[model samples]
Target: MPKVSRIIPILENLLFFWLGLALVLSLAGDSLNIPSLLQVLGRAHPLILHFPIVLLLMAVAMLWIKDEKIKEIGTWVLLLGANLTGLTVLAGLLLANEDYDGAMLFWHQWLGVASLGLSVLIYFYRDKSSSFLKISTGALAVAIVLTGHFGADLTHGENFLLTPIQSNEEEFVALDDAEVFQHMVKPILEAKCISCHKEGKVKGELRMDDLAGLQKGGKNGPFVVPGDLKESLLIQRIHLPEDSKEHMPPKNKAQLTDEELEILQLWVESGSSFEQKVTELESEEPLFQLASNKFSNQKSYTFDAASDSDISELNNFFRKVNPVFPGSPALEVAYYGTSAFDPTSLKDLKSIKEQVVKMNLNRMPLESVDLSFLRDFQNLEELQMNFTGVTPNQLSNLEGLENLRNLAISGNSLGAEAVSVLEKLTQVKKIFLWNSGLDESSKENLRKALTTAHIDFGFDGKGIIYALNPPKITFDKELFQDSMELVLSHPIRTAEIRYTLDGTEPDSISSPVYTAPIWLKKTAQIRAKAFAADWTGSLTVSDLLFKSGIQPESYRLAFEPNTKYKAKGAASLFDGIKGKTGHGSGNWLGFKDTSMELEIFIAENTSPNEISISLLLNEIAYIFPPENVEIWTGNQQGWQKLPNTDNAQSTKIEEVRFGMLTFPLPETDFDKVKIRLRPISKLPAWHPGAGAKGWVFVDEILLN
Candidate 1:
C-alpha cells in the first residue's frame, strides 16, 4: 500500500509535466491541425472533468478527519485528486482550442489550474501548516464550483441557471412603444452570436455586441444592411446549410429558433431601425405578432383522456371522430355527407360522450329536435349546423354546452328569440346567423343581448360592383389575303364591348363600338373590353390579324420552333388563311430572341413589283416587334442587298398588333429572295419585364 503511495507522487509529477506540454501545444491551435487520435481523446474532457471535481470535493472534506486510518486513506485520495486534476486540465485546454471561443475560456481554465495547484499544496503541507491546509481546501472548493459553472455556461448558455428563475412579473413594453432593433433584434444576436463575434473572440472579425460593432462588420463586409435582408451577412450566415463551416452559432453552439430567425429578417426588412415601433408598421406585418407575444399572458389547458375502444366505435363511414392532437382527450366529430346522415346513428357516438369537443353537421338534414342529443356532449366547444333544418325552438338545447365557443347555424329558421337563449352560455364567442330569417332589427337586438359574442347576419346587396368577364375575340380566319372579319363579344349578352385597331387599349366612350364584325384589310390590332350597367369594367382582350400577301412557291426556316408551341406545319405560313389571333393558335410561329431567317423561291420567275413582311406584336405576351428587317434578292449580281426598304415600327401602346411593312422592288427579275427579321434583344422600359429578351411571333411573310 505504501509502495502504491510512493508511485502516485511520481505519477502526479509526470501528469503535471504533460499538462504543461499540452498547454503549450494548444497555443499553436491556429496553425496546427490536431491528429485524429488526439482529437478523439481531447473530446473526453467534458466526461472526464467531473472526476476531479468529485475526487477533490471528497479530499477537501478529509482535511477535518481525526482518525489515523481515515487520514491515511485521505492522503492517498488527495494525491490521486492532484494527479487527475492535471490530466483533466490538459484535456480541457486541448478541447478549448479545437472549436471553443476564448472570451470566457481564460477564467474557467485559470480557476481549474488553481484548484490543481491547491490540491498538491494541501497534500504536502497538511501536518506542517494546519491553518494553511484549511484555507487552501476552502479556496479550492469555491474554485471548483465557479469552474464548473463557467463550463456549464459555455456548454449551455450564459447564466442558464438563472434563466428559469427569472421573474414573470416584470413589465414588458407594448408593441407601439418598443423599438424594433433595440427590443426585438439585439437580444437574439447577444444570445446566439456575441460569444463568437465579441471583442476578444472575434471568429470572423465581426462583433455583434453593439450597433457600431455590428455595422462595422468583419473582414467579409457589414453584418447587416439597412433594407436588404438577402444581402446582409447576418442573414446570409444564419440561412446557410447547418453542416456548412460558415453557418452562424456553429453546429455545436445554440442555434436560433424559427421565430428568432423571422424576427431578425423582419428587423432588417424594416430598414434595421433603432427607434421604429413594431405597431407603426402595417398590421399584416409579422413584427406585430412577435412584439405582441412579448407581452401576451396566454395559457394552455389540458383535457381528460378518451378510451381507445370508444374512439374506434364513434368513428364510422358517415362520421369522423379524432383527437385535436396526439394523446389529447379533446375529439372532433364531423359528418361525411348530407345523405349519409342518419338520426339513429347518433347513439353510436354515445361511447365517446364526454370526449367530443367539436361537431360539424353543416348541410345535413338535421331537424330542430334532433339537436336534443347534444345534451350528452358536455365538453363540446364548437357546433356547426349551417343550412340544417334547425328551428328557433331548438336553440334551448345548446344552453347546457357552456363550453361552446362558436355556433354556426346559418340558412335556418333561427331568430332573435333563439339568440336570446345563447347569451347565457357566457363562453360563446361568435354566433354566425347568416340568412337565418332574422330581420335587421332582430340582428341589432341580438347584438345588444350578447356584447361579447359577434352576431353575423350576412350583408345586403348594395354598393357592390360585380366584375365583368373579359371580352372574347370571335373571328373565322385572322390571316387573309385581302381582308378578314373580326368580331368581339361578351358572354353577359347585354354588355357593350368597345374596341380599337391601332394597338391601343379600348376606352368605354372614345373607342369604336363593336356592334358588328370589323373588317381588317391591312395587318392591324383588335383590342376590346366589356362594360355593363352597375358592374365594373371587364379585362381587355387583344388579337392580331396579319394580311397574307402573294403566297411563296417554297420556303425554308433557319430554326425549328419550340416543341410546346410548334402548332402547324411550315406551309401553314403561306396557306392564305390567317393564323388565329392568340399565340396558342397553331398558325402562329414563335421564336426566341434569335432572328427568323427565311429563304423563299418563286416557282414562276417573274418581276415582283412589291414585297411586304408581316409580323405580330404583343408585349404582354412577351412578344415584341423586330428590331430591324433585311431583305436580299438573287439577281445577275448574285444576292444583292435590296435598297430603300420600309421596316416594321414598334409602338409603346400596351396592346397587341399585327404589323406589316412594304418594300418596293426595282425593275429586276429574281428567282430567289431571302428575308431576315431580328427580334428585340430586350423589351422596352414600359413593359413589366423590361430587362428580359422579348419573343418574336410571326405567322406569315407576305410577298407580292
Candidate 2:
C-alpha cells in the first residue's frame, strides 16, 4: 500500500462533491426530509471517509505527473462516491428507526442523508440538461463540506481536526535502575529462593534464589520497586508477552502464583527492603539426603519463586546421582584412580535399586565381579573399559544391554575377530577402539556392518598414516615475508619439491626445494609441492602448499572510475562489488594469496554528497549476498555500512564489523586512514554452491 499522505486527499474530494449535490436537492425543497437525508450521509460516513482523505490526497500528488495510474483511480473514485452515497442514504433510513436526542448529532445525521439523496438527484439531472451530471455532482460536494464542519464540531469541539501531537518528557518517570534494585525491592526475595543463586549456578543471572543476588540482578535486571508497581522492572517482566525476552518467569520455570506476587507487591509498597535472616530458628522437619533422582539440585537453577519444600527435595536428590561427573563425560573411571573408586562404596552402590546407565572398569576390579551380576543392569546405556585386562569376549555377559548405546574399549588387547561378536548388538551407537590390537580391515568391516555406529580404533589399521594434499609448506608466517622457512622433510627422503609462483597452478617445477628459508619482497607466491616415486620415478604422489609474500610496510592505493562512493546525501558510503576470487569454505588459502591495501577518499562533485571507507583484513576472499562490510576507527563510538546501489560493486565487500548494521557512513574529510582488518564467511550450510563462490580483490576506493 502507498503511504497515507498519498491516499487521503482523493477520498476527501470525492466525499465533498457528493455532499454538495445532496444539499442542492434539499434546498430546491424536495419531499426528502433533512433528518432522513442527514441519516443517509451519516451512513456513508464510515465507508466514504477514508476515500477522500486517501484518494484526493493522491490526486494532488498526481499534479506532479509521476504516476500514470492516479487519473484512472480518480475516475473510479468519482463513480464510487455516487454509488456509495446513494447506499448511505438507504442505510440511514434503518438508523432513523433509533431515537436520537442531540440536535447537532440529529442535524449532522439528517443533513448528511438529505445531502446524499440530493447528490443522487444531481447525479441524474440538473437545471441545465446538457451539463446536468457535472453541476449536480459539484452541488452535492458543497453540501458535504457544510455537513463536515458540523460533524467536526460534534467530534472534537470544532478545532480537533487541526492540531499536532504533544510530546512532553516530564510526564514520564526518571528513576535510576540501581536505585530501583536496592531498598525499594529486595525484601520480597526470601530464603526459599537461593539454592541456584548462592554460588556457581546463577542461571538466568537472576539469583532470586536469594535476596542479595536479587538486588544484583542477573542477565535480566533489578526485580523490584518502591511505592509504584507500574514503574518497577519486576512488574514489567510479569506483564511481558509470555514468550518475550522481557517476560518474567521466563519460560520453562515456575511463575510466581497470584498469592506469591501479592506478597511481593506488598513488600515493595512497604518500602521494599531485604528480609532478615534468623539462624537460631529450627524446624520440626529435618532435611534428609534426597531419596529420588529427577529433581536433583546437582543441576542448578534460579527460580523466580519456588516453595522451600520444592528446593530441599531437589537438592538432596541430586547430591547422590552426581557420582563424579553426572552430566558431563565421566573423567575418573574407577580403575584410573583409587580415590575415584572405593570397593566398599561400589559394594553398596551395586545394591541400589536404581538402574545404572554407565559402568567404568578401566582400573576397577570388574574381572573379579560375577559376570552374571552385570546382567541385572538392564538400563545400562554406556559401558567403558578403557585400558583394562578384560578382553572383548569378557563383555559377552553384557550382550543383552537393551539400553546400551555406546561402548568404549580403547587401549586394550581386543582384536577385530573378537570385536565382531559385539557388532550383533545393533543398539550400540558408538565404539571407541583407539590404540587397540585390531586390524584396519576388520575395523572397516565392522563399521560397514554397523553403518550407523562409529568405530574409531579397534580393527582400524596398523602403521603410520598421514594425508596428502595438493601441497602445503610446514612453515610459519608465509605472508608479510616473515623469517620462518619451509622445511620439506618427510618420513622418508624419496620426495622432491616442485611448485609454482602464480596461485593458479599446483604442478611441480614451480620452485626449487632446499633446507633453507626463502625470502623475497614482491608480488609472488610459491607452492612447496612434494613429488615422490614408487621405487621408479615415472609418476609422483601429489602434495602441495602455497606461500605468498607481501610488504605490509610498503603498499599503494588506487581508485577506479564509475564506482559509487556514497548513497546520496546519506551518512553511509557505498562499495558495489561482486564476488572476488580466493579460497572459501573448506578451501583455505593463506593470507598471502588474498591481501590488499585499500584507500578511500571523498569525491569532489557528485549527485550524492559525502562518503568514506572502512574495511578489515581477512585471510579469505569469501563474499555472500545479504553480505555486510563494517569499518570503524579505534576511537569511534560505532561502525557503519556501505548501502547497496544499482551498481553491484556498491552492495558487497570482504570485511566484517559489528554493533549496528544499516548504519550511515563516516564523513569524507580525513587524510591518513589506519584501520585493523577483521573478516567472516558463510559456510556451505548457510549458502548454496557450498559458499565457495565470490570474488576478493582490493584496490583504492572509487566513486561514481
Candidate 3:
C-alpha cells in the first residue's frame, strides 16, 4: 500500500487545484452557484470544502513523520489523503461548474481549473526524484497555495486569517475613562506630576495629580474649584496649544487621556476625598444594599463548595445585604475544596456556589484543594489564595477562572506549569506574586502569554521605599536663587522613598515627609522611603532637581544692524552672513555701527544649548521664521521651532536648529527691531529625518 503521505501529496495537489479554480472563479466575476448546489447536496460548499482541507493537512502531517524507514507505512497513508483530497476536488469542481457568472467570475473559473490541472501534473511526479520534475511540482504547488488563499479571502475579509490578532487587541479589559483614571491614569500622574506646583518655587503652581492637586492649580491660579470644569486652571493648561507656553505637561512628557480627565472631573464635582481605593471596593455591599432594603424579601444564596467557610464568609458578608439579581438574589456562589484541603468543606461551600463573588483563602493551605473547584466559581471576581500551596499541574483546574480578575499566588510553589494555566483566563489582568518563586524567564513568558492583563511581582513584605524628587529651583527662571521652591512627590497609595540633597539618606527624625506634593528649594538634600515595617526599599535618583538660581541679564550691549540697507553700503563685521555651531566660547560678529547696509551672518556655532540673537531690522522690514521667534532679555530665552510638516512658504522664515543665521548691521542702529529669531528645533543630528530644513534667508535687506 502506498504510504499515507505518499497519497497525501497527491491528494493535496488535487485540493490545491480545486482551491485555485475557486479563486479564479471569484476573480473572474463568476456568479458561482456552486455553493448553493453543494448546499442542495446536503453538503454545502462550506461543508464539502472541509474534506480537501483535512486531507491536504493530513498529507503534510504524514510528511513531517521523522521515521523514514517505518515512514513507508505512513507513505501509504499519504496516498489515502491524496485520494480523499481528489474526491474533494472533484466535488468542488462539480460545484464550481454550477456557477454561471459574468466577466467578474471568469478568472475565478480559470484559476480553479488551472489549479486542478496543476495538481494532476504534480500527482504524476510525486514518485519521481528527478530535480526538474520536483521543481515543476514545486511551482505548481506555489500557484495552488496562492489560488487557495485568494479564494478564502474572496469568501472572507482581507484579515480573515489574522482576525485573531485584531480580536485579541480589541478585547483588552476595557476600563472607562473614569475607571481608567483610577488605575492607569493615577499611576502615571503620581509618578511624574506634583513637582513645581506645591509651594513657593512653584512654576505653574498646580500641585494635584489628586483631588487636591486639581483644586490647587498652578501659576495660572486655581485650576478646578468645586464643580467647575471651565474655571479649572489645570484643565486650561491641558487644553493649551501643544507649543503654547501654557502647555501643562511641561517638556517631554506624556499627556493625560480624556478618560483620566473625566475621572478628575467626577471626583472634583463631588469633592472626592477617598484616599484608599481597594479598601473601598471591599465594602461596596453597603452601597449596593442601602436602597434595596425591602425587608420582606428574604433571599437565600445556594452554592457548591467543599468547604463551609467559603460559604460562611460569603453568607456573613451578604448577611445584611441581599443583591437583587433581576428578580432573584443577584449574588451567586461556588466552592471547590477536597478532604485533603477539606473536601467536605469544598462540598459544603457548593450549596451557595453561585453567590460566591469573592473568596478569601489567603495563606490557607490548598495542597489538596480540589483544583477542579474553579469550575464552580464562575462568579468569582476576587480570589485571594496567596501563600497557598499551588503547583504547576493542579493549576490547570483553574482553566475555568475566566472571571477571576485578581489572583494572588505570592509565596507559592507555583512554577511554569501554573502560569501556563493562565492562558485560558484572558480576562485575568492582575496576578500578584510578591516573593513568589517566579523566575524572570517565566514572568516574561507569562507577560507574552497574557497580553490583555498586566502581571506584577514584588519582593514580599518589602513594599516600595519611596524616593523623593528634588524641588524645582524657580528663581529668575533657570537660575537658582536662595528662595527657589524645592519639591517632592510620592505614590499616592503606599510609599516613602528616602531622598536628600545634602547627599544623605532622609531619616524619620530628619523631618518626616508626607506623600503629598511638597515645595521648597535650597542646596539642601531630600529623600523618602516606605518607612512601613518590613518594606523593600526603592531606588532613588539623587540630585533629581537642583534649585535654579536667578540668571543675570544676559543680553550683550552691542550695536545690531537694521533691515533695508542701501544695497551699496559698505559691509561691517555685523553686516554680513553669519553661521556658527559648537560649545567652545562666545563667537560673535562685532559691528562698529549698523550705518552700513552690508549683510552679516550671526549664526549659532553648533552649540547644543539655545543660540538666539535679536535681529534689529530698524532700517527696513526683516524676514525670518515666525515659529522660532523669542522675546529679548528676561526669562524669555526659551526656544521654539515650527513642526517639520509645515514647509517654509515664500513668506515663511527659514529657521534651522542644526545651525543658525544672523546679519547684524554696523552701518545703522535702527529704531524698533523685531527679535524675530529663536533657536531651531533642536533634535539629535542622528534622529530620523525630521526638523532638518533649518535654513533661514534674510536677503540681508528689506523694506518695512
Candidate 4:
C-alpha cells in the first residue's frame, strides 16, 4: 500500500508533463523542426501505443468487478493506464509532425487526446460511485477505439479494417481496348507508389491517388513530362538510387518492378497520353507488346462447365484436361508423354467437347490418330499440332472448325494441298505453318488467298543467323560422396555440346565436345555452351558440382528466414533441392538485411575437407552474394576458425545467376561445423538501392 502511494504521485506528475508536451507539439504542427532523437522516439509510437490500448481496455473491464480486493487492484491498473495513455498521446503528437494530414489524421489526433483526458478523469474519480466510474470508463473505451481506428487509417491507408471484405476483383479489359494510363500506368502506381503518397499521408506533398494531383506534383515539378523522360519527375525519382532521399518510394516500401519500370519509361517515351488506347501505338513497338501482355484478350465463354467427374476421368498421365484458368468454364486439353499417347485419348475428350476451347497435340504421334475428332469441338478457338506428324490429309479435318481463331501446324510435312483446306477456314485469324513443308511461293499464295488471316511461315533460315540455346546440363547429384556424372545435351540434335572442365568460358574451337557423361572425382565448375555449323554459339551456362567428404546428420539455422521466402523451413538448405532463378519459386531461403548462421552436426569419424554454399544473385531485385563467409569447426570443448572467403561487391547489374562459395577446411576431426554468411551491409553506389542492405538467398549447402 505504501509503495502504491509513492508510485501514483510520481505517475501523476509524469502524466501531467506528457499532457503539456503533447499540447505544445500538436500546436507546433508542421512548423516545428523535430530533433533527430525526437523523430526516433516518435517512430516508436506505433510500438508503444498498442500497450496502452490493451492495458486501458483491460482496466475498463475491471470496473465491473464487485470484489473489494479486485476493486483495490483496479485503482492501480487505472493509474498505470492513465500514465501510459498520456505517454502514448505525446508520442502520437510527435509522430504527427511528419508528413501526416487529412481528416483521418485530424480525427485520430483529437480522439487520442480525448481518450487520454478521459483516462485521467477516470483515474481521479476512482473513489466515486460504481455507476459514475462505469459510465466514464465506457466513454473512455469508445474514444480509444475510435482513436485506434483512425490511427490505423493514417498508417495503413483508408479503410484498412474493411479491406478484407472489399472486392479487389479487376475488370478484364481487352488488349486493344485498354487505355494506356488507366489500365497500365495507374495500376502500377496503385500497387507500388500509392500507399505512401495517398491523401492522408502524402510523403512529399505528392498525392498519387488521382491524375490532377500527379500533374500538380509535389515540392518538385510535374510527375511526368510527355515524351521527355529526362525531364519527368516520376522517371527521375524511379531511376534515382533507392537510398536517395528523392526516390519515388522509400527503401522500406515496395519498389517498382523491372517490368513496371520499363512500361512507365515506354509510356513516357511514347508521349504519356491518358486517353491513348493500346491500339493507338504501333504494333511493333515495345509498348504494344507490354500492353498486350498486361491486358488479357480472353473473352468470357458462354459454354457450360464440364462435369468434375468427367474431367477427373479424362485426365491421365499422358492426357490433361483442365480449365484455362480457375473458375473458367473453357477447358484446354494437352497431351504429354508421346509413348503413352493413344488415339483413344483424343476421342475420350468427346464428353466435354463443348468446353474444350484449346487443344495442344504438339509432338504427339498424330499420324495414326484421326484428327476428325477435333471437328466435334465446335467451340475450339486454338488447335496446335506442332511436330505432331500431321499430314496434308489430316489438315482437312480442321476445315469445319468455324470458331477456330488460331491454328498451329508447325514442323508438319504439309504441302500446297493443306493450304486449300486452311483457306476455307475463314474464321482463323492466325495460322502458324512454320517448317510445314510449304515453300515460300505457296506461303505467299496462301497469304494472298486468306487476306483477312495472318499466315506466319516462321523464321526462314536463309541469311539471318540465330543463336542456339544454351545446352541443358544435368548431374546425378550435386553433392556426391565419391564422384558425380555430369551430362550435357542440346535441344537441336545437330548442334554439338562444347564444355570446359575449368571455370573458363567454353569456345567452339578450343573446348572439348561433350559425348558421354563426364565423371567428376572432385569439386568442379563445369561451363557448357551449344555450337552448330550455321547458328551462332550459345551463351555459356555453368554449374558447380561439390564433392562431399561428410554428410551431416542434422542441421539448425540461427535465425528464421523471411516469412515471404522461407521455402520448406530450415530443412530446405540440406534437402538437395536447388531453387530456380526466381526467389518466389519457393525453393530459396531468403534473408533480408540479416546474416545466415547455420550449424551442421556431423556423424562420427567424418572429417569434411570443404564446405560449399550456393547463393543466388539478382542485382536488379537487390539479391546479392554474401559479403563475407566464415567457417568454424568445433567439438564440445572448443572451436577452430578456418580460412574465410570474401566476395568482391558487384558494380553492375547482371542477369539472375547462381554462384558457389567454397571454403577449404583443415583436415581435422570435428563433430560440428558452423558457417556464418554475412550479406552485403550496403548496396554499391552504382546500384539502385545504394546504401540499403542487400538480400541473400540460399537453397542448398554442401559439406565436402
Candidate 5:
C-alpha cells in the first residue's frame, strides 16, 4: 500500500507533463522543427496505442462488477489507463507533424485528446458517486471509439471499414467506347497507389489523384513519357527490385500484380494517351486484347471446384495448379522446368480436368507426349503452347475443347495442314501464330476460312522497323590467367551479332560475325551489336576483359564495410562474381563516410604489372565514383606509395553502370599490395541528399 502511494504521485506528475507537451505541440503545429529521433518515435505511435485502449475498456467493464475486490482492481487499472492515454496522445501529436493533415486527422487528434481528458477524470473520481462515475466512464468509451474510427481513416484512407461491403465489380464499358486511360489505367492507380500519393498524404511529392498531377510529376521527373517505357519514372521505379529503396508502393504496402504491371507497360508503350479508345488500336496488339478481356462480358463456368487434396497433390516445382481467382471454381494450370517434364504429368491432371479453364505448356518438350490428354479438359478456355514441339497432328486433338476461346501456338513449325485442324475449333476466337512457320499466303488462306476469328501473325514489319535490342555479352571470368571464351547472343535468331576488340564501334559490313565464342588471350574491350536484314541495328554494348598476371593467395580489408552491404567480407572482392546495379544485391561491399583499404598478398616470386578495381556508379542512389585511388607496394620491411590518380567528379545523374579503373604498375616484385579508395566526403549541391556523405561500392579487384 505504501509503495502504491509513492508511485501514484510519480505517475500523476508524468501524465501532467505529457499532457502539457501535447498541448504545446498541437498549438505549434507545422511551425515547430521536429528532431529525427522524435520522428522515429512518432512512427511507433501505431504500435503503442493499443495498450491504453484495451486497458481503459477493461477498467470500464470491471467498474460494473458488484464485487468489492473487482472495484479495487478497477481503480488501479484506471490509473494505469489514464497515464497511458496521455502518453498515446502525446505520441500521436508528434506523429501528426509529418505533413499529415485533413479533416480525418483533425478529428482523430481532438477526439484522442478528449478521450485522454475523460480517462483522467474517471480515474480521479473513483471515490465519488456511482452515477457521476458511470457518466464519465461512458463518455470516455465513446470518445475512444470515435477516435479510433477516425484514426483508421487517416491511416488506411477514408471508408476503410466499409471496403468489404463495397462493390468491387468494375462497371462494364463497351469496348468501342472505353477510353484507354479512363477505364484501364486510372483504376489501377487508384487501387494501388492513391492512398499514399493522394491529397492527404503526398509521399515523394508525387500525386496520383488526378491527371494534371500525373502530368506535373514530383521531384524526380515526369511520371510518364509517351511511347517511351525506359524513360518513364513510373515504369523505372516499378521495374526496380522490390528490395530497392526506390521501388514503388514500398515494401509493406500493396504491390502491383504481374497483370497490372503489364497493363501499365502496354499503356506507356502505346503513347500513354488519356483519350485513346480501345477501338483505335489494332486488334492484334496486346493492349487491345487486354482491353477486350477486361471489358468484354466474361463467360460463366458451371463446373464444381476440385477437391483441396487433389489440387495440393498436383502442385510441385515443375507444375502448378491454382484457381483462376480467389474462391473461383475454375482452375489455371501451368507447367515449368523443361527438363523435369514427364508425359505422365499431363495424365495426372485428369482429376481436375472439369475445373481446369486455362493451361500453359510453353517451352515444354510436348512432341512425344500424348496430347490426347487435353481432350478431357472440356472447360479449358485458354491454352498456351508457345515455343513447344507441338506438331500439326497433335494440334488436331484440341478440336474437342469446345470452350477454348484463346489459343497460342507461336514458335512451332506448323505447315498448311494446321489450318484445316485449327478451322475445326470453331470456339477459338483468338489465334496466335507468330513464328509458327505459316507464310503470308497460308495466313491469308486461314483468315479467309475463319472469318469470325482474329489471327495475329505478330509484327509484320510492313511500315514499322524495330531497332534490335543489344546483344548480351558473357564470359566465364572477367580476370583470366590464361584465356577465356567470350560469347555473344541475341533474342532474334535471324539477327547477326557483330563484334570488335579494337575499342571501335561494330558495323555490319566490316566487323567479324560472332558465329563462335571468341577466345581472349590478352586484355581487351569487347563491343558488340545486333543487326538484321530488315530491322535497324541495335546500340553497341561493351565490357572489359583483363589478363591477370598472378593470382592472389588471399586478401583482407583494413576496415569492415557497412553492415547492410557487407557481402562476404574480404572474400567478396576475389569471388569473380560481379554485383548488379542495386546495393541490395549481396555481391557488393559498400562504404559510407569511410575509405576502402584493401591488402592483397601474392606468391613470393610473382610480379604484377597492372591493377584493376571494379566499382559501381548509381548517382541517383548517392553511390559515386571514388574521389582518389592510391596504390602501395610492400615487402617484408615497409610500404612504398606509387603515383596516385584522382577521378573526375560526377556532373549529372546517370543510370546504374559499372566502371573499371586500371592503373599501370612499375616493374617491381612485391609480396603485398595495398589499395586505398576515398569516397566523396560531401554530395554535390544538385543531388537530392546534398552535403550528405556519398557511398562507394566495390565488387571485385584484379591484379595483372
Candidate 6:
C-alpha cells in the first residue's frame, strides 16, 4: 500500500506536468490536427467527467468519518481519486482542443485541473500536514462545484437547470410597432448564439450580449457591414451548412431555421437598424408581411377601460362583445354559431356603444332596415357584413362611421352604388366586394369613388367561397410507361397555374408558372396551385407519377378488390401511376381484412434482380404494411418461396409514409412471377384506433 501510495504521487506529478504542456498546446490546437488517439479519448470527456465528481465528493465525506481505520481508507480512496481526477482533466484537455466556446471552457477546465492537483497534495500530506490539508480541502470543494456548474452549462445551455424557475413572463409587442432589432432579431441571437458569444463566454472573442459588442466585432472583425450580408461574418457563419464545423450553434446544438435566417438577412439588408419598425415596410413586400405576421403579439389591451359587466350583458349565445385585446377599452362585437343569424341582435349591443370599435356581423341575415342601428356605432373601425342580404341603400348607414378603416360586405346583393357610399367615410382604407352584384365597369367606377381605399374582391379567399375555386390537375392518363404529360386547369380561364415538382406545396412567388404540359420521365410528385392577379390563390393539387420503363403484357389477381376501390382490370398493377397518401384519392387499391396474391406475366423472358412494390401506410385509416411478403419462382417443384434477401424487417411503428418496398429475387429466367402479401389481422395497441381491421394499400408494382 505504501509503495502504491508513493507511485500515485509520481503519477500525479507527471499529470500536473502534462496538463501545463496541454494548456500551451491548446492555444493553437483549434487550427491544428491533434493525434487520432487523443481525439478518440477526447470523445469520452462527457462520460468520464462524472467519475471525478463522485470521487471528490466521497473524499469530502470521508473527512467527517471519526474512525482512524476509516481515515486511512479515506487516504487510499483519495489517492485513487487523484489519479482519476488527473485522467479526467487530461481527457477534458483533449476535448477542449476541438471546436467549442473558449470563454465557457476556460474556468471549468483550469478549476478541474486545480482540484485534481489539490487532491494529490491532500493525499500526500493528510497525516503530517494539517494546515495545508485544511486550506486545500475547502479550495478543492469550491473548485469542484464551480467546475461542475460551468460543465453543466456547457453541456446544456447557460442556466438551463435554473431556467424553469428563473423564467418570468415578458410583455408582448405588436408586430407593426415592434422594433426589428430588439424584439425579432436580438431574441433569436440571445437564444441561439449568446451563450457562446456573450461577455464572459465570448468564444472567438465575439461578444453578442450587447449591440455595441456586435458592432465592434470579434477576432475576425465587424459582424455586420450594414446592408451587405455577403460581407458580414455573422451572416456568413449562420448561413453555413449545419453539418459544417464552422456553422453557428455548432454541431448538435439547436439551429436557426430558414424563416429565422430570412428575418436576420432582411434586418441586415434593411441597414441593420436597431429602431426600425415593421410598419415602415410596405404591405405589398413579401418580407414585410412575413415579418409582420411573425412578430404579431396577441395580448390583452393595456388602455383605459371597458365595463366588463356591460360587455358581458351585451353578449349572448350567438353574439359576443369583449375588449379588442385583454385590457383595451375598445370592444369587438361579433356574432357566430348560428346558421341563420338574426339582425335584431345588433340592438342589444347599443349598451356598449362608446366602447365598440369593431363589429363582425358576418353571415347575418340582414337587409337595409337592419343596418339603421350601425349608425350609432360611430367609433367602429372595422365592420364585416359578408353574406348578408344588404343592398345599396344600407351602406349609407355606415357613412356616419368616420373612424371605420375596413369595411367588408363582399357577399351582399349590393350594386356599385353601395361601394360609392364608402367615399363619405374618409378614414376607410379597404373595401371588399367579390360576391356583390357589381359588374366590372361598375367596380372600376366604385374604385374611382373610393380612391384612397384598397378595393378587395375577396382576392385572397382560401375556403369554399364563391369568387375563387381550386385548380384541378388534369392528365391524359395517370400511368405511362416512358413519360406522362400533366395539364393544370381551373374553372376560371383567367387563373394561372404555378407548380413545384419537388413535392412541396406551390406558393405564388417561389413556384414556377405552368404554361405547357409538364413531362415526367422518372418517378416524380407534381404539386400545382392556381392563382389570379385579382383572385385568391387555390389549394394545391398533387399527383405522383411513376416511370418504371418496363411493360407487362398480362397480370392476374387471386382475390377480387372491394367494389368501392376496384382498379380497371389487371393492367392497373403494371400501370406506372403512383397513388397518393390518402384512401379517398382513388389512386390506391385497398385490401381490407384480406391478404393479396398477384401474378404477373411479361412478354419477354427476363430475369429481373429485384421487384419493388409501392405501399401506403396511414395507421389512423387502418392502413398498415403487410405482415409478411413472399415471392415465388416457377422451378421443378412448380412454385417455391424465393431465397430471403439481406433486407431486415423494421419492427418500429411509424406515422403515415408512402414508400417503395423493394424485394430481391433469385437470378432465374421465368415468364411468370407470383407475390403473396399477408396483412396484419388487427391493429396494435400502440395505434390510436387500436383493435381495428388492418388494411394494405398497394399502388404500382414495378419489376426492375
User: Which one is best on lDDT?
Assistant: 5
Q: Identify the leading candidate in terms of TM-score.
A: 5
User: What TM-score does model 3 achieve against the real structure?
Assistant: 0.28
- Greater-lDDT candidate between 1 and 2: 1
Give Cα distance to truth, residue 611, candidate 5, Å: 2.2
* Model 5 residue pairs with clashes: none
Per-prediction TM-score to the true structure, in the order listed: 0.40, 0.32, 0.28, 0.51, 0.58, 0.45
Per-candidate clashes, comma-separated:
1, 85, 157, 2, 0, 7
lDDT of 5 by residue, 1-704 (tens): 89989998998787677777877877885788889888887888999999999999999988878798998898788889878888888889888877566677788888898888777777777778889888888888899999998887777867788888999886757664578999999988988888777655667677787688899887788899998765688887775544468877686888777677778878988999988877678886889999898885333456788999999999999999998778889899999988998878799999998999999999999887789988999988899999998999999899988888899999999877788888787888789999888877788988988887878888776788889989999898767878998999998999999999856799999999999989997667789999998789999999877665566988889999888689999888887677765566789998885799999998877887888888888775678888778899988888889976766778876656776777877686678999989888998988655786778889888777
TM-score, predicted candidate 1 vs. hidden true structure: 0.40
In terms of lDDT, model 3 sits at: 0.43
CA lDDT, candidate 5, residue 513: 93
Question: Of models 2 and 6, which has the larger TM-score?
Answer: 6
lDDT per model, in order? Answer: 0.72, 0.42, 0.43, 0.81, 0.83, 0.71
Candidate 1 lDDT score at position 174: 44
Tens digit per residue, CA lDDT, model 6, 473-537: 87766556677777787777888888887567888897899888887765566788888875667
Candidate 3, run of 10 with poorest lDDT: 614-623
Model 4 weakest lDDT span, ten residues long: 239-248
Q: Which model, 1 or 3, shows the larger lDDT? A: 1
Tens digits of per-residue lDDT for model 3 on 1-704?
46854856656665566555545544552344445555464235446555544554444444445567534543454445445544554454454444222232244335545544544554555456546444644554564565566445434323345666664532122211113235433544554454333221134444443466564555556755654444555444553323335555664555555444444544444433444232222223332132123122333335432344443464533222234344443344323342334444555555555666666666556776666866786777667677778776666766676667777677887766666776666877677877767788888888888986657677533454543333222223221334454444544345454445443566645646554444554323344443444444444433322333222212222334222222222232223332221100122222212211221222232111122232221100112233343222111343332223331322322211121222222222222223343213332243221233222222222111
| Candidate that beats the other on TM-score, 1 or 6, i.e. the better one | 6
Report the candidate with higher lDDT, 1 versus 6. Answer: 1
